[model samples]
Target: MSSPEKDEIVVQGIAASQGIAYGQIFLFVRSEVEIPTYQVDPAKRIDEVARFDRALVMTRQQIARIKAEVEKNIGPEEAAIFDAHLMVLEDQALIGETIRAFESTGNNIETCFNLVSQRYIKAFSEIDDEYLRERAGDLRDVTQRVLQNLLGQTENALNRLADQRIVVSHEISPSDSATLDRSATLAIVTDSGSKTSHAVIVARSMKVPAVVGVRNLTQRVKSGDWAIVDGYDGIVILNPTESTLFRYGKVQERKKSFESRLLEANREPAITKDGVSVTLMANIEKADEVGIVKNFFAQGVGLFRTEFLFMNAARMPSEQEQFVAYKSAAAALAPQPVIIRTLDIGGDKPLSLQADLFPKEDNPFMGFRAIRFCLEHQDIFKDQLRAILMASAHGKVRIMYPMISGSEEMARANAVLAECMTELKQRGQPFDENIEVGAMIEIPSAAATIDLLAPDCAFFSIGTNDLIQYLLAIDRVNDRIAHLYEPTHPAVLRTLQHIVEEAHKHGIPVSVCGEMAGDPVFSPLLLGLGVDALSMSPAWIPSVKYLVRAMTMAEARALAAEALTLGSPKEIYARCDAFYRARVKMD
Candidate 1:
């Protein structure tokens, strides 16, 4: 089928996964499922409940099998999305509500499940935050699985894409995206999705070009029509002219050359021209991402966010499961250190276990979260600690606690770790007796009281992402005030300087593992601040390394000192921008 008009048309969206591609549009129109509602016989209520249970079981098994496949083919990080899906399927709130609906209205099990899932999907879709909004896709993904089981539907249309084509859809769920033939699919264009959506996560993992949140995209393009997907800029050109295609072809070649250079710089040391060596590490959300760290030649896994294990699972992960995950990563980065952070959930990433464990708070970001939650629930806390300690013997694994506010919390947390160590010893289980422990100095209170907290800790990791927001008294997720969330703010710089000074004074190293750490523009300022290490996304390591290799420690220190003297963010940005421009040129 051909498009009505051939004039060049462009649609913009969030640039989810980076790449460039040209292909014929393969419109994936989702025909609405005709769901019928009716009252069931009172005598058959038991059977109704059993039917729902069986369908739920089938859905869970299907997702779990997919999780295993994804873990084997892609990595554990990508497979973690299915864990979240399983949690959604097993959500008590959702299940309870559906059961109540079935009991009250005697409606078909499929109808009740659909109604409850729609309510959740609608609620998540209306959220202002991008992360929460993207969860709507997750709810829908799980809901569809249950519905498919109830209806006995087999396979997604995505599985039928036998030829290479640009996929255009209303929205691609994580499950649907997981079944996609990445080698055959040229690119992805969706009318709805967030940057943090599971679809985007899978696309990034598969290295497929994707453009999401394009309104009415499915309606704009038809099957067999020529299209161009500029994933780098989040633009989709439908019914593209030959000239436009020619231009993008050249652009693709240039991008390939630039990326090749970045990859080539991977094996080189991240050292300054003056011979000052800096540790460049990767901040991974899961153990599977350790492979990327190796690919990028990162010094180590700086921050292994263990929260994914808890947040993604249907229930709390057992000690043995957590042990295997931690061990896998520790073994992957053997000899080099892998700092495994304990579970840090309850704020934006809520636990899936019970309602009382994670209550809805108006300001959850600053509410009872992180170390506070773990401390209150020691059973959960101890399980994680035991797992970390058990995994330590696999390699150079260190333990780090998140959201440390003062010395008291550090002491209490350490006491718990010690208790776990003692128990492991009593059982004659092997573990690293000399495992190092550290604190994540993200809170303003923690930074201010670093002197007291530093002595008890082995190292400090500066979480500038939270530190900046809290220091500036702004919520970065709040778009109206997001502009105020400045990393180069004067107060932010001062706080970082103090944390580094206190940590160094105590003879401990400090690393920046936030968005700023990955930013090439802020590399000199952070280095000058006396930061001992830098940890960021694996993809940014080489570029940041290139920048590190080009400058002398003296130049970086001079730039940092001048930045400290600046009074405003604008001025600080100017200094860093001028220095970065003078030192490095874009390819």
Candidate 2:
């Protein structure tokens, strides 16, 4: 009997990467490994432990090979995805837990390791932050690889693909994504994933279309089935009709043309039609990403998240190590301001190497995180400050603190900076004593008291991501209430206006460095509200720059004025969207 005929199906998911692809589905499934469990005799326990050690060595070598290949095929930034994998391998806490489990229970090494790793995976997966929650996938990937190596199983399904096809899976791990053949893989589709997942990072780096979080997509489609992957709008069409294909071909052409126009406009300065210049900057995680910053024609670095330096390492980076990293970015973008945000760890971004430092909290976001964590751990905070000071000697460098609730927190942070400066001076270190310091206005108290906080700070950067979340009291990652976390809400808009007005009163310029800042739709509204600069991911700069160049400041202000009068978020957003669409011709 033949397989039953299936009708066309359309599935919606999160758009992980932009582009379009139409090809036969290659359902790449890796079944869960069946581990053999057996009791280990006391004498043979040592031998079992030794066997486990060798398996770790083998897993390390395999990951190293994959990392090297990824570095060669893609760029270093994308290859940095594997850095987390290597960190997992070297994690003493995880390794020690596995050993303890085996010694206590006398179970096989595989069972002990599996139990420990699964516990960790569960913890990370339950995290409230999307970026951190995706890390669970990293743990899952490494665990499976180690288990397979111990069982002497070699599965390289992705590498063995003989033809180009749309790769679909339940969840594509970082290791599996790194090994993907760019020439043979048409696009990547997953039943579960997010834009922040390592696999999605690889897909974006490869410029391959990817649609993720399509619930039960793997079960819906099978191998050899035809599908249209619309990564732009996060729609996947199975068994697309000839008419649908024709329509999409034209849509693809239009999208490519629009992207080209955005790039072309990016090469020019971000000046409005009325000759008002806007400072467009990039938010970077690592020093190596300075190349991308310049490539996107950004004026400078707005938010250099220093927590990545800690999160990626097996231990806290020394002052000298951090100095080198900060200096590289400063020097690379010399003459351009590099605003380094001090360690914003805790909550979603936990340091596995120093796990004991942070205790579990019911609500880590508003709990002992960011400025609170730094103030209590003054030693760690001072080291980062000194490094930023040293890097300032090389090029333009400024410091910004995250989650400052009010002036008292700002004063405490500044007092520590003063201590670092005094120590640097005593050591005969040449540094920028007049280096500017800024505070992130994310907390409601900080925003409410901007007038009080502005006097102590040189600048202010509105962290709209957190600000909106706190202002609306909605968990952004929660799908059910995420819609309630609206930036266009009257309260959010009014608060932003108040911040800008107050910051300007004290002669301090304010910039927005959040998801909203990068969006072209919101850029004009922010500028109209008197924001001095916009900082966002480098890739998004082109489109935002294009929008800035397209309209006049007067028009932006008029749009903002109209939006402020609107009663509901839907109405306000509609007005903003119309303003953007009117200025930028998409059709």
Candidate 3:
């Protein structure tokens, strides 16, 4: 049953990420093949084993074909996620588990795969964290696809699907997304994801329309179906007719045109029409992302998360290797300030060196983590400082200490910095003595005591994600409290404005390196609040630049003043919304 000529069959959910896009619904259909539990002759075990191997080989080939076909039609960038999916197929974890279970239980591949998947799924289900719990989807996706290959039933519509604008799956496993006609598939949607999730990373790189965390998309959409995806707002509509498509399609085109116009704006200073020059920086986790700065033509790197280098590595990267990575990245993007935050791992990612850090804590979020761990474990702290010092010679590097609470913490940390510098100098290593140091205002205490800590640091980068979490005492990753994670919350805004104001009073440059900086909804408020710079992912550069170049400081400030008076988060957002709607020129 299709909707009327002008009507759209829209699917609604909590909009995770924001953007508008039009695409065909590329349903990522998956079926988990069960391991047969039928008793087989002990003598025929060899035959059964051979059968399983053949099935595995054939499935691999099918998946490979699907990947190749989709990539060829859609474009490699659009479909490259399947490569990650392909890796999962070969993962020893899933395949090995199935084999082990089959060997031990004397069950066929179907029963073994089910047994293994269910066990891992159960374990994942018990986890309280949404990020960890949702990992079950990936586990299930990978195990099922690989099992299907083993069962020789890999042929599916997604294998050779073709489209211009595609409505991607709830979560397009890297391998599954690879097979597509990108021109045909214009947008992507997923049921489960965070901004940092791999699928979104790939989508941003491809520069397509995407709405993540759209639940049950695969089940909601069908083959050869048309859908409207508000990639900017996380809205998906099934069976949107031509007229409905045209209305949104025009908006999509205008958004594209507006982003193109901002390419020049990136090169132009972020100074608003009223002469308020806000520093526009980029947030990056990988070395390759340095290119984003140049591509978006951003001013500098606001938040260079060094944890990625440390967390995903097999072992500690040698000092020389760290120097090379940092040097190459710095030299490549010379002149642009890069604020590297020391490893802020513990709750989301744990270090093997500090296994006992969280001792039976009820809330790891509030546990002995972040800077607390660094203070206790001076050895680890020293190594990271040494690495940063060694790399500073490459270019202008700013050090932003994470989780700092007060002046004493900064003093104690700086004292250790003095010691590390002494050791490095005695060892004949050259370092930057003039390299500026900054502090991440993530915790509420750090913000409250900004006057105490700001004196010691060269700069301040407010990490709003954590600040809001701590101030409200709500865990954003927990579904129950996740909705409360509002950047527009008056308390959150007040804290953000306070940090910027305090930093400016001390003559130190202040920037926002949090996710809020990237959001279009809150970007105006930040500028109005007197943010010196805003750093976010590079993909947001164009959309963000459009708003930045169009507004005057007077207008932004006026909007902010009214926004502050609102009681509800929704009300604050509405005032800001009304202001932008009336002011933003529709080209």
Candidate 4:
């Protein structure tokens, strides 16, 4: 996949993040493993079991250490994958099966353990689902660690990345990625991985530019080779020519210039030239990301995804654990409201504790997920509710529910929340009794019922990421149809206009907290539609603010008027692109 011009080779891959980086290539070559097999005496079978138990303890401790490191450097959601590895190590079925084999066959600990692990890995690999099949990678990861311990192999390849370079690797294990030096790593170019891999998720949360699934990426480049990672376009240039380097260097400088403008915009109000005001906020995954909110000068957290608490543990998080996390974020942004979205799990996000509860489905996106899962599992739902309520007393915290299809789902969710409040009241825990509750308008039915749903809630937050997907019946994550997921489609605009119109009618404010909210090109259109607020990743706040400060309500309204008259996404996109170029001078 590389170009014929060796010094100017261009390779394409999946764009895991958005940015540009230029640096020397630092190939992360992993050491190979060779497991040895030997026979054990019949009387020494018990000793083989002891050896296996020791390896398990060592691997668990190692994974915990890596988890803590990743949580500190990256975020808790990325670190949570290690919890699955720990679970695999502690699986009673796996360990018991291995012990039985060792005792019956008089085989060595390595042989018995490898045989049992392979069976489990093979079973998961055979699953038809992509997500379930990915679990096979986890099994292999844990088993490799145990085998490495039994083989006395303690070397690590990612320990010395203190020299700044773009990390080039064939395949990076999550455990190894945790050990990478953030200061030294400018970007990442991997030879193999999909968008769903945890390694890509880690790179994204760290704000590092990355391009994965670059076939033969490692084979074509050597250490110290000049590389340009066009993460915005998912291109990796190895041994880039002088002209190519010069071109990207200017692009990088322009990007820096735009970022400088965003920084300057931080001090400005998110107000239109015509004196219209719009609130700008951040969508955070963990409490630690509150620092980013403050740094970007976000008004508050519009969507604090509380699912991280459930995802980080092997089982349901205790009310106390959940309270501590929610309270920290809310308290950090005191006076400013932090709207915590509770338990948006199921579908893609399966809990390790309740994997058996949800079977495979043909269409998980439309299946039992989000609010549907919460209402069905009230115990898990209530525990999170109690925590959110308890945390509300510490600061201005609000509760929001995701994937609400209609008034019935919202009513059932409100019922469970009320029950939690009653239980908390009996326990005499102080909380904001008047904390506001909101609903996310993601599904078309929810948008259609905004009039009914809005009156019951204090506000509305449109989850445009999923709304656009569901509206178009396109899975944005599926690269095959990702091109069809258009945010600027006429139908999407009309739907958003409907929701906003309905919310304003009920005297409730509506905010967009999805990818559209962060994009500068769509900013004018959204403002024209009269959305009260926009919430996005913390990094987008400043740029969006800059764009917000430039336009007048009259101009934005005119743009929206024209955009609404358009028939196709292509036409709408062309208009927006022209408007953005004129506004930002990005090119």
Candidate 5:
């Protein structure tokens, strides 16, 4: 009988980062910080509060050091992850609530702070937005550090690894991930995490292979177990057999070769063999990400998510603050258009600052969100428009409104933009008077009525993520029905074609600024459908550009035409996948 060491055990997880690694596992299990709970004497309660303050100060310093190290090692974009952590540290709501909890419960400061922090963590975790929900990890990480400092316990950090090995953990926080030694850390395997988690973001920046949500991976393997991590497929094979190792060795070579090809192609323009040029742009959340946009060779910012500025703040950002942030990205990529999206709050993204304004609803996605929220709250809308307009004076900035259902909504949003332009003029503020306005065609109604709305817009960007979700009536966050949210569904393809056609008829260029735009498999079909541009996460630009450079417009158009005739989404996707695989030469 073969021993357990000879037996191959494979675990499947979500591929958080791309690469391959084979090394001994360094099972990094951090014991939970045990909080001491007891009633504090009335006289010493003030002392407990002071103890909390001291802990906060120490935690802030620790995060600052980590941020500085990350900035030095990785680029400033990755360092911005810690900025959110620092914001959490300085949040008045969290601090005030901790004090209130202590005052009300008369519990030990550690216990009170933990209770208040847990409430905040729970609230964030429950948020429908994936990005916002991932923030719960940041909050949890910060809270644990504060509790540890208050209790005078040192953290179990992965900064000082004995050797290069795969770091296996239940979850790695941004703070812990920041301190990870690149030379000593071979790869990261987490039992719980998502692609959007800050830890995963750090892993990607460090160029380390990472597979997350591996169930109870930590429980199964010892620290010395040898493992093969396939980040491409999100697979981890523990105690791999000789045959399995050989097979994976070949897979690694092919993947590395393909990645090299992608990078080589990324340096070139995204032009088809038929001489048709496609503008490849990036979707950025923060101004700090301008560096990443340039690094990936994205032509411009197709989608600048303004909601992140609000999400990171304790209160609504002032117009001047918003202008400075917008201007930073605009000026950095001067002459390269920065398409600033208006506030897309509601649905999954709710403002903690104005919770009363967005009451819980049965279906928040269709309720008050994006353009509807902006139209109703014109005060907020004008502030953002004014900022975007002001930033345009510094660089090539364009404004786009999200979730426009029809022409009426487009007109209403444009009216607000006009008011901002007028206000800026009265104040003698410099702005691009001809700063173009665009509408996002994410809603099914917007897709159907693009002809009516296109006249009021300078350009159209298809937000396939939400469009597919609404088209299929699928709650993308719902694990049970998420698989039903198919981008290649006949209805989705038809809608996309209709939207592009309608926009073209009105002489407005159309671009896709969604997950579908980045995927190599779907990109050819989109380009074939006559989209003028594609915008996605900066990292994905290279892969999409590679595919574009490999294929001709004639072939892409043929693929799209054939796909339209196919009745099954699987069939359509298979066709697209075949087209991508043939040109990519990964096999």
Candidate 6:
């Protein structure tokens, strides 16, 4: 791993919680923040205000250019996420709020910016919706620039770190994640979030290794501490020896080779050696994701995160608007089944109008969220259901309820759905009654009651992330207790096994859309548990799909049986690795 050092050999602390990635360095300095100033020189103040506004316009143009260039350089969908980020650049609420704070208080630009950005960011962070939570980061990134510009600084006047710096921060704010150019960023090191946070999402989207929630990341790794980040296991190493570097260098190469092959895997079908075909689908959020699905040749959109529709809308979105969104998705995927989850917004999703929806609770995890809200508020629930039913007429749509407890809850939910259908029929509104209805087996109670629920629903989507959380009583997002939240745990595996078997016994298909579904090591285990389909991130499609084709039904079953007999989570992981590596080559 030791090579001849150039003039400035840039070595950084890698937050390799995602894995090691080797690519050309792309350096990016965040746009300067604009501070609001009031000099009382009305003429001069107005002119400067105009100038600041003009500069803001130019900054927006620059963001648009970067977005298009990144999209053109990479892929459209990758760029589209940034493009969506750019939308906040032109947002009126953000702009008004930032400037208003300065106008109202005589606070300097930094104070105003600190106040305004923090206010909105806190609000966004409190939102339960995953997609909307990202917007807070977007706003933070832009607002920082606005404040910097207002302070009359041309650049972020922090200490000079490196020509190619991997940011080692206490926490990677969404703003930091958005503004960093992946080409310049060696990797990201932070002390916050599990795999589902903005840091992990950005790293994965950019194919960079990000280690988040390291207790003392900034303090432990000094300036220019030669470090290595293992994103695969969320490990950050400082001042690694030559031996470790050499090992990581090879690991990086092997990882690259494997990823390249997964891209090529899309061209081939997921067929077993004996020729059994497995359906592979991508879980998507934005409407633009449909293109990625087509590009990857995905069988269909397995999970369409409908939460995007509810984000940024005033009040409830009309049934027609919801219908159009679902219809467009259904028509885009055409014969392929679109499992439309009915607004999985709760806990952290920020709904501007629904302050009452998010009641103060001791535990937000077990609080009034998901289907509980639907049961309490029929109008909103019916609005979403009506939209789904209408979309069903356009193409195959499967309606899914999140956080189902038992048959009674599901039956009550369906009762409303039936009323919606009846109303549609009475109005001569065309919709598909054959649209499948299902529940998310994320709650442990739901897993226990799967037998009672199977006969009432069309299918079951086992959301492993939450199931593991509820089963083990550990929050995946909390760093302190995340170690306890292992998906391969005996209790968790048994739950997955029971639900999958119960669903199959009643001739119902059970699919998994959680993180475990995307893991190559767990694919065989899932199939062994009798999972019919796996819906994961669009990027993971080819790898998991390829894995599906390599193992046989008998092999999968044997692996599953062995996993059941395992006593420890570590043993389960070892067994999964050995089982898959023995046959599939782990690309």
Candidate with maximal lDDT: 2
Residue 208 Cα positional deviation in candidate 5, in Å, after optimal superposition: 1.3
Model 6, TM vs. native: 0.81
lDDT of 6: 0.71
How well does each candidate superpose onto the true structure, as a TM-score? Answer: 0.85, 0.96, 0.81, 0.83, 0.95, 0.81
lDDT of 2 by residue, 1-587 (tens): 11236567789999889999998999998789999999999989889999999999999999999999999999888888888888889888889889999999999999999999997787677665567689889889999999998899985557768788999999998988998888989899999889889988999999999999898999888899998999888999998877788998999999889888988888999999999999999998889999999999899999998887886576788999999999999999999999999999876566677778888877877888899999999999999999999999999999999999999999999999999999999999989999999999998999999999977899999999999999999998787888798899999999999999999999999999988999889999999999999999899999898888889999999988888888899998988888888888755
When summed lDDT is taken over every stretch of 10 residues in candidate 3, the lowest stretch is 347-356
Estimate, for each residue in 1-587, the C-alpha lDDT of model 5 and write its tens digit: 11354668888999999999998999998889987789999999889888999999999999988888889999787888888888888788788888998899899988888887887787677665577789889989999999999999997688889989999999998888988988999999999888899878988988899999898999998888899998999999988877787888899999999898888878998888889889999999999889889999999999999999987787889999999999999999998999999999875566756666786777777888888888989899888899889999999999999999999989988888888889989999999999999988899988999889977999999998889989999988777898798999999999999988888988999999989999999999999999999999999999999888889999999999999999999999999999998998886
RMSD of 1: 4.0
Q: How are the candidates ranked when ordered by TM-score, highest leading?
A: 2, 5, 1, 4, 6, 3
**Candidate 4 residue lDDT tens string, 1-587:** 22336657788998777689888889888875677778898777777788888989999999998999888877776787787788778676678778888777787888888998887676555442344456677877788889899888884647577588899998777777777787888888888776546666677777889898898888988888878898777999876777787898899788768767778878888888889888999988778788889988899999998775664355567989999999999898999999999888776565544566666767766777788998988888898899999999989999999999999888889888889999999999999999899999999999998888875799999999889988998877675887898998888999999999989988999999988899888988898898989998887787788877877888888889999999989999888878777777554
What is the TM-score (0 to 1) of candidate 5? 0.95
Q: Measured by C-alpha RMSD in angstroms, how accurate is candidate 5?
A: 2.2
The per-residue C-alpha lDDT of model 3 at residue 440 equals 91
Candidate 4, position 504, lDDT: 95
* Per-residue C-alpha lDDT of model 6 across residues 196-268, encoded as one tens digit per residue: 5555666777777776657655554455445666675566655555667788788877777877777787688
On the 0 to 100 scale, the lDDT of residue 101 in model 5 is: 88
| Number of the top-ranking candidate, with TM-score as the measure | 2
> Residue 257 error for model 2, in Å?
1.7
At residue 42, give the lDDT of candidate 4: 74
Residue pairs of candidate 5 with colliding backbone atoms:
none
Worst 10 residues of 6 by lDDT: 1-10
- Name the weakest run of 10 consecutive residues (lDDT summed) in model 2: 1-10
Q: What is the lDDT of residue 200 in candidate 4?
A: 66
lDDT digits (tens) for residues 305-385 of candidate 3:
776565434355566666677777777788878888876766544542233454545566666666777888788788888
Better of 2 and 3 by lDDT: 2
Cα lDDT computed for each candidate against the true fold: 0.84, 0.90, 0.70, 0.82, 0.89, 0.71
RMSD each, Å: 4.0, 2.2, 5.0, 4.7, 2.2, 5.0
